[model samples]
Target: MLPDGMTRRDLGWAITGILGVFFAAMISMNVVVTALPVIVSELHGTQIQYSWVVTATLLANASSTPVWGKLADMMSKKTLFQVANVIFFLSSLTAGFAPNMETLIGARFVQGIGLGGLTALAMAILASIVSPRERGRYAGYFGACLATATALGPLVGGITVDTLGWRWCFFVGVPLSLMALVLVGFTLRVPVLEVRGRIDYLGALVLVLTSGALLIWLSFAGTPEFFDWISWESAVLLALAMVLLVFFVMIERRVSNPIIQLRMLVSRTTLLAALSSASIAVCLFGMPAFLGQYFQIGRGLSPTESGMMILPLVLGNLIGTMTTGRLITRYGRWKPYIVVGSLILTCGMFGLATVDSGTPFWFVLTVLVVVGLGFGAQMQNLMLAVQNTVQVTRVGQASALIAFFRVFGGASGTAILGSVMAMQVVGVSVAEVNGTAPSATYADASGTMFLVAACLTLPAVVLNLLIKEVPLRTTI
Candidate 1:
């Protein structure tokens, strides 16, 4: 037996359990992405509603992530992880049975809460046992699971929709999550911190309110064809969002255990890490949500064909993550990977910005590879940077903070970019009604959408360059 009476065989089981939890959470997300167009059309939802169905989960994930992260410190990580799975399965069941756009969106919000628990607690639970340096060694397995989910989710969703129905995309995730719940209960055993502090309900409330309001306002702004951006509706929401944010900061400063410890933000490294994480979030989660539209609507590909096209991106992500994780673990250094990843992000997205309907399949695949490479190199390493700077017990808070920002970035980028995309598409759709070709219109607008994301990558490059490379801890 090892020092804690845990054997090597036990580590293998624990990792399996964690991986299952991740796959259940992540795959359920991507599965719905490609199927969304069909769902919206079937439900007679608008462009804005379509974006909400996806981003609503993300917003809820962002809001509840810290709450779950904090819970890890006060309870059994294993129990919380299993509880999250139950919540996820139930939410998926609710979503699968949703008869309208409103019900589906509501179901997704609940699912996001469950996803927050899985995503945040999984990382925290692993950190509770594994050191940051060694995380790289095992991170490849994590990356592969993530990449596989990303790569296959759309493919499965497309096939399911074509053969069975769109509801199956939501339905299938339930069994997988239930399986993960059972597996984690049987396999995962870890010590909990059991920190003595009251939960920060006010800070949590304001954090969610501010974040939800901001994204909600952006969602409104995205569909300006329905309403003006300068209208009272947008102005009033934006005003409340700002006011809530100010109050959030104040509440955080006074709270015994803030959802996010305000003191952590003072670190230059943490700030850089936050910015870098935000940028990578745009690249990883925000950018990919639109490919189905481009392939099916813009280029007239079949669902299965569009699913096939997603493989290159998934493979690209897998290769990047595997390469970066091994190197970081070996060298115990992460700066070069971050720099290279940022550069790849800028290059890949900028290249994709010029794409049109007739853009070569090979060229698009190549650019997606670069994006995957960049995403792989940056995403996990940024988390490592943040965790290294904090006390071990407080790693949950740090991980949640970085994760919270990623949720913020992913939701905000999708909202803003989705708006830009919808406005342009609707403009051209109106023109199409007046004789413009739908394919040509969508292709041109898609290029502009990518260009906006590409331009956003530049700031991240600057932030990554500025991150102070503090020495990583060699032990937990």
Candidate 2:
């Protein structure tokens, strides 16, 4: 080991490598949201399938996150980190060369598995090295990377799809991932434990089945031929999901080394923070997937112009995230920001609900900026709160659990919103063709989808009110 205490140079290299990996993974996910429409049209996919491209990744990531976290507790984190990178590298290449939508979706699933490992392991490693008090300062820096990636991913992806091709979006992650691999190899080292236990394969299986069934049900709900609640198929799927979830919970209680620890979920701090994290994701991840389409299809703007339109939202997110980080460090409290962020989000979403084809561009931008700010302020605050409450030994479980719920919420939200948009499009299209009035199918879908998105943010505000602010400790 270099020394008992960390040097500034050592910390700098660790933070750089960690943030670089985070930036690359986040960019890879968000970049595709703006490019989805173009990819779907080019590949001749239906709206449901297009939505699955996003949902599949989120589901895969959410499902695998806790497993990675548990593995971090038992294995060498550095070695595991390299394993994730290699998977990401290979998946990117396969995604770039995919001949059809099916193959692309499969590749994206593998990529999500890699992403889940990277995010969970990174946060666990950071927590291991940093104290709770100093973590806020570093959390700010990490938040900045997340905000930058979220903001830039769309603008860059949109431009690339329009100018280069959609395939470049996948290929682009390779070099960034490679750079991260090299940095980690040279700069970071953590002590490895050789402890071993049986992996909770049964619990993992049940959790996957539960999440997958619920997501599939949501995606098909409101589609043309999908089952209604009263229908036999829908009832069976819903019952199966309930059964699997209950079984998973029972398994967790009995297992010595559960994939997800039951004790973590029982903590009030973890429960509230987790629910809040999931709520924020529903709005943050769901809204952007369709907003780019709004600018292009509804307003008739070029892809580049559409990307440019959302820049205010990105800027607002950066400002809000940085501001919250500083305030938390100074006050050592988190509840007020969560409350304020939620209220702001509610106001912004309500404002956005009124958007239509005739709405001014400036008005839309202003509404979205408010939503972005609220999301930025609240999102990572929840994570910080949960991490601080848990012991160092359990930090990996706590961090990964928060991430799991957020991505699970994201996957479900995207599928639900996409289905809603599809139904509206089909309904409007058939009506227009049969009646005297004529309108483009794309325009109707874009306008209606945003209105629905705005409605979804309201529930998040209610959930935010339920989060209790626990005082932060000055020491670990």
Candidate 3:
């Protein structure tokens, strides 16, 4: 049931407000994409450092997502969303004024924590107000927010870098966040369920450390300055990550209210959704992180041109999402969309695997459109499928868990693929002899990165085929 006394119009306004916050959070993530090469070169950062800049945020966001979801179940989601917005606002300001890459990375990490809260809270809020059957239509809007923000982020980042400066990329979100804060405060009205639970502090801490260790291992290992992949340091870090993961699993099993409920994942649909989400994330998160470098460093395009180049991808995503969403709601059959979407995504990835600096732009752009269309059809729909299987009261946790895996997968993909790219870069192995530089090396190396990413999506295609789609529930 919708919240008592909440009309459809009220819900629309509330959803609008929620999408605004979601847009701001997502836009902040991508705004630096087009400007990253410039930012890193000016700051004198290495390729590893460049990867860390993006990985840090994804890691922080992934780690904190479960905690935020658990908190929403026990408190007021509207209030939590507002608080996260404020945190994002402050972090963006700090990032804008940062004097060095290290400081900017630190700020982005904190911003990701806030982003975790916003992402989880927005989905929870939607679940609370909309039935799973009806949510299919709204899911399109969520996808639009994601795609639109992604689309605008690069264009805006490009324009900001070309005209005002790259610093303005960080400042751009400030006003949007402030506006979302005000809109949400006035329009959002949802029932806060009275639930009793303790926050899983130890579980959350260990999960963070575990992911951190694994990412750190991926980021620096194999570089000559750091320990090689076969070295003792790699062994130690890998071992530490495994041990902490075991501890985290143990804590979840024993906690009164686990950050991520182990039992919920036992369901076939939920499990498949988690796997599919992670697999899709490999391409969704990993590709764009390097696309900027591919165009600017490899093809020698300006930030603005690179930004404009991606418009087709975003456009395809926008249409696919909005169209698939309405079809799922109208027909009440979601499996076919995902099944077909995954195949298309897989095909698109392979197509991209062949691209290099010298590849024709028309062919690359066509493949991107295909990839976006496939991804859009599955991304939010996977969560919708999972939410259908869970109880209304557990929606917050269920949604958060899927998101956690997606973000974690994205983080892992960024680090692992980044390491793959770094290894391929011409001077990385000989950086001591010749200083690191961003050059045509990225152009030559990008194909291997996309090939690796393409291999990762194969599992997603298989997993989506395995998912048994239960009918979406009509009640919240």
Candidate 4:
């Protein structure tokens, strides 16, 4: 930790450097969403291929998180930050120059590896330096940066695709990442924990394979035309994933220093925090992906217009997160926010389920703002709750575990919702052409998707109610 009574500038530089890397990585991931349709159409890739473009990154991210977190615990955070930034920069360049959809997708996978390191390591480092009470203020700032980046990604991506090309969206992240690298090199300093231990190569491999297989299964589950539940290929892949996952658990149990500590997961706080993180991920990531599509396909809006319409959600998120941060610092309790946020989220989602092709744009915007507020209030609070509960030594692992589940949930949620939307559209089209009475040009699938999302969050609300609030730590 920095010397006691460090100047505000010292704090400013550290926070800025960490948040810069986070903003760059998050913006790069989100920018592609609005540009996806244009990118796929230009490259002649199918919708399934388009979905994989996002899923591939998420898969790499989820698999690599524990590895990065372990490395952060064992090595210099400065070294890891530099390495992650360099990898991110190179991958961004490669993606910008990718000649085909396949190459772009491959570049995104590499980018995700770099991003996983930066995000998990950055958070771990911050938590190490700050008291839990003060950490929320900084976490709030980080949340604001994330909200801003997410909000701007689609708008900037739309403009780039319209004027220059979709490739520039990838290029845009390079300078930001470079800036982060420079900031870390100049301003950030943390002692490396030197340790001699064998890396868990087998555990890592099994975990990656298991996660990749599950993601592939989800991606192609309903779209592959052979949704045959009893297919030999499906059974084989499913069995392989389950067996590998079980082996990974066994390996973690035996390792001297596991990549992820399975013991922490048994704690009620950790388990509930992970579940809450996953539920929020499903709500946060699933909505934006489909909202862009809804605007373009269902309502015939341009990419730029669709992005502009979603700005209110971002604004609400910024306000809610910052406010919650101050409130948590003042009250020194977190459970209330979780319960209240989930209930608000449920209400917003229920409202969203009634949206249709003829629904007013204002109504849709209002509901999204409500959803964003709920997210801002709950997302970081859950992580903080988990971080406060764990001892300092295991903080990195605990934090990474929470983030890992959140990303995994997001990836699975997007694939699941996309599949639902695809089936709904197909069913509507088939029925319409078969002489079924049709009053509308096309059925809106967004409402149905929101209903399913609401159902998923209902359980999360119950889980939140059970979370007991522990007092904020006063010292490290």
Q: TM per model?
A: 0.95, 0.94, 0.96, 0.94
Looking at model 3, residue 215 earns an lDDT score of 87
Q: Candidate 1 at 9: error in angstroms? A: 1.3
For candidate 2, give the lDDT of residue 275. 77
In candidate 3, what are the lDDT values of residues 1-476, reduced to their tens digit?
Answer: 67887877777777887888789888888888888877887777788878888899999999999888888888898898899899989999999998998999999999999999999889988998889999999999999989998899888888999999989999988877888887788777878985887889999999899989998998888876577999999999999999999999999999898999899889999999998898889766667768877877777788888888877778878888899999999989999899999999889989988888679999999999998998999999999999899886888888899999999888888998888888888374212212233355677788888898888888888899999979888888
Steric clash count of candidate 2? 0
TM-score for candidate 4, please give it.
0.94
The TM-score obtained by model 2 is 0.94
Q: Which number leads on TM-score?
A: 3
Regarding TM-score, does 3 or 4 come out ahead? 3
RMSD of 1: 2.4
- Model 2 Cα lDDT, one tens digit per residue, 1-476: 23234566876786788788788888888788678777777776777887888888888889989888887777777788789878888987898788889998999999999988988888887777777766777788878888888788888888998889989888777888888888888777665654578988888878888999999888887688575545777788899999999999999999988999988888887887787777678666777767776676666676667777877777778888899988888878778887898888778877877777677888989988998888888888888889999877777788889989989988888888888877877644322232132234555566667666666666666666776777787765
Looking at model 3, the pairs that clash are: none
Error of 2 at 450 (Å): 3.6
* Model 2 C-alpha lDDT versus the unseen true structure: 0.79
User: Sorted by lDDT, highest first, which candidate order results?
Assistant: 3, 1, 2, 4
lDDT of each: 0.81, 0.79, 0.86, 0.78
Candidate 3 residues lying further than 4 Å off, grouped into runs, are 428-438
